[model samples]
Target: MIWNLSICFMSFIFLFLTSIFLMFLGVVFIFYDLCYFIEWELLMLNSSSIVMTLIFDWMSLIFMGFVLFISSLIILYSDEYMHGDFNIDRFIILVLMFVLSMMFLIISPNLISILLGWDGLGLVSYCLVIYYQNVKSYNAGMLTALSNRVGDVALLMAIAWMLNFGSWNYIYYVSVFNDSFEMRVIGMLVLLAAMTKSAQVPFSSWLPAAMAAPTPVSALVHSSTLVTAGVYLLIRFNSIICDNCLGQFLLLFSGLTMFMAGLGANFEYDLKKIIALSTLSQLGLMMSILSMGYAKLAYFHLLTHALFKALLFMCAGSIIHNMKNSQDIRYMGNLVLHMPLTSICFNVSNLALCGMPFLAGFYSKDLILEVVSLSYLNMFSFFLYFFSTGLTVCYSLRLVYYSMTGDFNCLSFHPLHDEGWIMLGGMLILMVMAVFGGSLLSWILFPSPIIISLPMSLKLLALFVSLIGGFLGYELSKFSLSYDLQSLRYYLTVSFLGSMWFMPMISTYGVNYYPLIVGLKYYKVFDQGWSEDFGGQKIYNSSVEYSQYMQWWQDNDLKIYLISFMFWIIILFMFMVI
Candidate 1:
């Protein structure tokens, strides 16, 4: 008992203090435009050396600070959330290791060291996802692990490709070899790695499937650590992918990811999955703008999104805890009446996700949309950007409608209220940040105001779309038990939308089908057909027959020997007579 409380306190206190120090250093570095790199060579053979490197700049430091800050709060929150769990210490340690891996990825400029962090994230995330010890969790863990393995392979290939350059420090070569063919290959491989990590397009399935993890893990994984690791990598390697094949394709897939996740969230009933899809949507937004060569904007949004999304998950976690571990929003209604504080926190976080004006998401999401509108682009890209934005609002409002309003569908007179101040403390911290984080980040990130010269119609487009989306969300929610819901009426379309356009199925079964079919056919032709006649089966039959004859002869060994001796003697006499 003492050990459990002590570990949580020790981790939280240490990390909280460290995060504040790092944030202060980050601000100082940004103000002075400073960067420092430390390289340690472990092995030198001939002219090339295997070296590990860490880069400290404003970006890496600030991101590290945010990750640790969230981690600390989550550890504090977990003290209450997992109070009765058997493996509380193991859970806390895994969370710490997850944060450490992210820090490794954030600070490293070398591909080798970055991969160290990347693979650590994959490994730790698998452990966390399957922490539940259930069939569903096992499957989700496998999917998460395998989907991320694609990125690992891509990273390994990238490191192999970098061998020709006699260096693994990709930062030094990005600009120097931008147009070279070799660099292009490396850039594509890195982009592949980022896309899988960030859960863009086809790779997007695993993000929601990974909801099998505990909510605190969800908060960390979705908010700042695992999912964002890819986006952070892209931000670092942004120079290599700009205005090239990698960048253009990034836009396409990320836009699709955004639209798909937003649309999916609307139809999702599972509370955690909806939020997971929301995280996917935000990641797509980050990747889409990053594709347009706005790494700074992406980074800004990443930080702000991290703040609120963490809060959103924390609130959701509290609700789930109070509601007897139920996550279905359908069975939950009028929660505002029972869990007022949590409902308030949830609404605030949801609005922040929808990019409500003056919220943290607004500064970055709005800025990104406006900047993209300013650029010369095709209509499809433009529509995808805004429609996806509206979908974000749509699902958020729908979530509010389903979970906070209507009737109390929970158990009769079930007590669903705040348990203690500890969990609420963690949530309140993030809620405050969610409300003011954007403006704060905006002021610091952009010291000078961004003046956009746009027509009034274009300026109001975001607001107009958001209003329409909110209206649609309400319209979508007006149903009773008298008749079937529109979702049931249009089952197929809803399924298609709800299922991330069948990506999980396609990536899993669709990908497996052909290879498995080919293997089955090979087995039929070789193992069952030709091998049965000419290979191991036939050889086994012959060996069995010969062994049986030897056994019979051995059983009649004395009689057989007498017969053989008489035959040999008769043959010798016949030969002598001849």
Candidate 2:
């Protein structure tokens, strides 16, 4: 007990020290804002000379706070959660590496540094996902690595294009090429990279697969770190995306992803998988908000989402841990009775996630809706926002009902106790923020000067819609929805067909990978021809065949060696003569 208490105390000390360092970093970032506002060209240029200059910006500070907060929570949770687990040292190392990479990623001032951090985060995440190295975890890690490679390639292409056609410095590159066609292309490519990284739309399947990993990894990656990379990219290049077609594309794609992921979450039985789907949906909503020229709103959502989502995931982790690693929601029921503290934390986070009034999600989600409503690009975007909100409520309620409220039926699984005080302490901190985040935002975070006033009516309307939607979902949840196999089949077929068409469009236009199809055909032909000529199965069967052939060759080896040597000598002599 003394050792355990000491460990928990040490973890808290580490987190507190880290938070102080991050706060100092945030203060340093304010100086960059000053330099940018003053138009100090010399300061701007020389700022690139020093690595510390990367720390100077409001955006970087905001994201850095996000990284620090989420990472600290995860670390604290892991202190107890991973107490007796083997490979604890490796887990802690990977967790620290993940946090360091994300810190560097948000603060990097140049594309090269950003990519370095980006790849580092990907590498560390891959390590964490397959920490156990079981077959399923290994396969999940491989898929994650491949998807991240795709995102990295797209990001590299965009960086290359920017270097060739625009400036190389982060702010300069965005400002100098703000109105150019190449900038638009770069913006679109960056969006594609972000989509893949954030698990948007067709690229979203890997996030659920990632649930095969440990819950701590899921909490870290999905809740706060890797999944937010795309949003960070967008936020970094907000100026470039604001006046381009890429922004419109993001709006549409994000809205669609939100709706689709929400629908999928309603059908998911796995607790972590449902939370994974929620992450995708919320990220889509964030992207859509960013698309509508509301960087502040998007950032607001990002901050709130990180807090509540991390809390939810950690609480889910605690539950899973209690249940001896069972992830199926069907096996979980009356958990509130079994684990009251976790139940309260989970419910609080879920309420925030559902955008209940006065919660963190409520403020940011309403703000996003308000921004979209005011912009009102078209009927499609408007209706998409409405539908997405309704679906968000539907899935949020679905998760809460399925996981917490059902009758306890599984006797084979023993009732487990709550997490340690340290775990509960971390959760309680997040829960307080989740409940009071909106008030904090309004009272402190919003711009003081108020250069532009938001639409009051639109804000009110969005809040009303969100509240009504949640109520509707609660009512709908009173009766179980009947499952129709035929309807499910039809929906699956349509989704698959739509994705088939949609993938090509997004790849060709959004991602700018039109040559992929041609490359696929060429690869197919190459594979087929290789298989036909090689007698594919015979190679594995014929290790001794090579030995026999080698023996036969030995009989003629002297003659063949002489001929080969002479041929090489002749070629060399001819080259020397020439």
Candidate 3:
């Protein structure tokens, strides 16, 4: 206990200090207009060499600082969150390794190094998801790992294609070869990898499924580490994707992802999965703008979204912990009466998520909406973006109504109170950031404010939809005993929307259905039927029978010795006669 607690304390201090230090370096790097690289040769072949390279610049440094800072607070949060678990030490180590892996991904411009971090995130996340040691956790972990493995395969292909360039540092060469078929293919593969990581469209099921993990891991994964890795990569490769066909492709799917995820979250009853789906929706918004050539705005949203989302997850974790680990929001109502502090933090973070005026999400989300309006894109995409924006607000308000308002529906003797001060301490810190992170990030990221000229109708459109969505969210949740639930009348539509448009089904059983069936057939035909006669088991039996037959010769060796002597004497007599 003492050792584990010490590890948490020590890590918080070390990482907290490092985050501040790196933040200072980030500002300095930006001020000086400087970048540095360190290369250590890992392998060399006649002309082509594989090198582990590290880059130091404002972007990587600042991103790393935020990641570590959140990780520090999460470490503090988890110390109390996983208090009595026998494997608390292991949990801490995994989280620390997760942070390190992210640092690896953030600092390296090399595809090879990024793969190290990418695969690490996938693997560590699987371990974290299954940390609970239950069937659901195991299944969710498999889904998460397999989904991420698709991205890994895509990245590996990208790396293989990069072999044509003689160096893996695409940062120095991608723009030069932007028109080349090779670079285009690499961009597509990178986008595919990004899609899987970011949980866009069909690959999105795993993000919500991963809610089976601990909330601290969810906070980290959703906020800064796993999901955002894809968006960050796209931001770096914005040069190649701008105005390209791949950008259009990303726009279509990201818009769909944003729309679908928001709709799904509104239908979801599980508290953590609702939050997880919201993360997916936010990632889609980021990707959609990046596709439209606003990488800075995407990155701006990424940083701000991280702050509130992390706070939101912490508050949810606290609620779940006190609610007897019940994640069902149906069991939670009138939480404001019992846990006033948490309710304050929860609503504030949710409002930030809804892009409430002057809040963290507002600065980024509103600016993104305005920028999309300014750009000339297809009408279909524009509709998806605005409607998805409304859905985001709709779900935020719906979740608030279901989980925070109404009557308390939990067990009569529920643990309906706030958590320890340690947990609240982390929540309070992030809550403050959720309020101010957007403006701070906007100032630091863009020295000069972005100005957009728009008509009054266009400018007020976001606000208008937000108000409408809020009304719908509340009205949809308000039910009397005689009220007809639309879900009952439209079962298929509700199920389709609620289940992430059958994406989980498609990603899980749908993709592997045929392969699993084929494996079953092979097992019946080869292992059970034909293999008995043709495979190793038959060979083993034949060898044993042959050995038994040879054993008789050994047993009769003494008797055969006398017969052999007589035969030899007769053969000698015949030879003499000849």
Which is the better candidate, 2 or 3, if ranked by TM-score?
3
Please report, in order, the local distance difference test score of every candidate based on alpha carbons.
0.90, 0.75, 0.90
Report the poorest 10 consecutive residues by lDDT, candidate 2.
34-43
The root-mean-square deviation over C-alpha atoms between each candidate and the true structure, in angstroms, is 4.0, 8.2, 5.2
Model 2, range 278-342, lDDT digits (tens) per residue? 89889989888888778777877888888899899899989988878888877778888888899
- Once fitted onto the true fold, the runs of candidate 1 whose alpha carbons sit more than 4 angstroms away are 41-50, 480-491, 540-578
Best by TM-score: 1
Q: Could you tell me how far off, in angstroms, the CA of residue 34 lies in candidate 3 after the best superposition?
A: 1.9
Per-residue CA lDDT of candidate 1, range 89-169, in tens?
999999999999999999999998899999999999999999999999998999999999999999999999999898888
Query: Clash number for every model?
Result: 1, 2, 0
**lDDT of residue 265 for candidate 3:** 87
**How far out, in Å, is residue 41 in model 3?**
4.0
